[model samples]
Target: MFVPFLIMLREGLEAALIVSLIASYLKRTQRGRWIGVMWIGVLLAAALCLGLGIFINETTGEFPQKEQELFEGIVAVIAVVILTWMVFLDAQSVAQRQSTTGAGSR
Candidate 1:
């Protein structure tokens, strides 16, 4: 329960930060007039996400137990692959930066 609560809090903070950043950028660029448009876009995005989640949940509810397990396992594998890719990319970037700095110092 606490884990889920923390996850929700983190997601809410992320959305808030994104909106704040966008608003700041708009104000700095004198595009404040389009702030309403940005809000509309955000609302639409949120609605779409909610709709997708509902659709997936409802669709999966009809699946057999074995199929549901299989689906979940596939999703977990995909998530692991994506995470691994991200880690490798980050490590490569750090290695590149270190190599460049080392070369520059010599």
Candidate 2:
């Protein structure tokens, strides 16, 4: 339960970051008029996702409780593994950056 929430939080943050960057670029380029179109695109994408989710939920309504629990467990495990891997990679990169900066200072 907590793992799924964390995964959703991370994904939501990433999507927000991407959207903000694009909006900033559009404003800087004086193409702010297209911002409306961008927003429309965003709305359409969101709607599509919602619809897809509903369809999938309805389709899986007949799934056995045992199977659903197993699937959820598998997903949680995968999410944890992926999150751990990302943290490891991020730590490595940060360490490398610090070492390079330290060497430059020396």
Best by lDDT: 1
Which consecutive 10 residues in model 2 have the weakest lDDT in total?
97-106
Clashing pairs in 2: none
State TM-scores per candidate. 0.57, 0.54
Candidate 2's TM-score reads 0.54
TM-score for candidate 1: 0.57
Ten residues in sequence with the least summed lDDT for candidate 1: 97-106
Alpha-carbon lDDT, every model:
0.73, 0.72
lDDT digits (tens) for residues 1-106 of candidate 2: 9998997898677557556656765674467999999999989988998998799888875568898889878977885676566556555655675686664421
| Candidate 1 segments exceeding 4 Å error | 61-106
lDDT of 1 by residue, 1-106 (tens): 9987986786677667667766765674468999999999999999999998899888865678899789778976775675566556555655675686674421
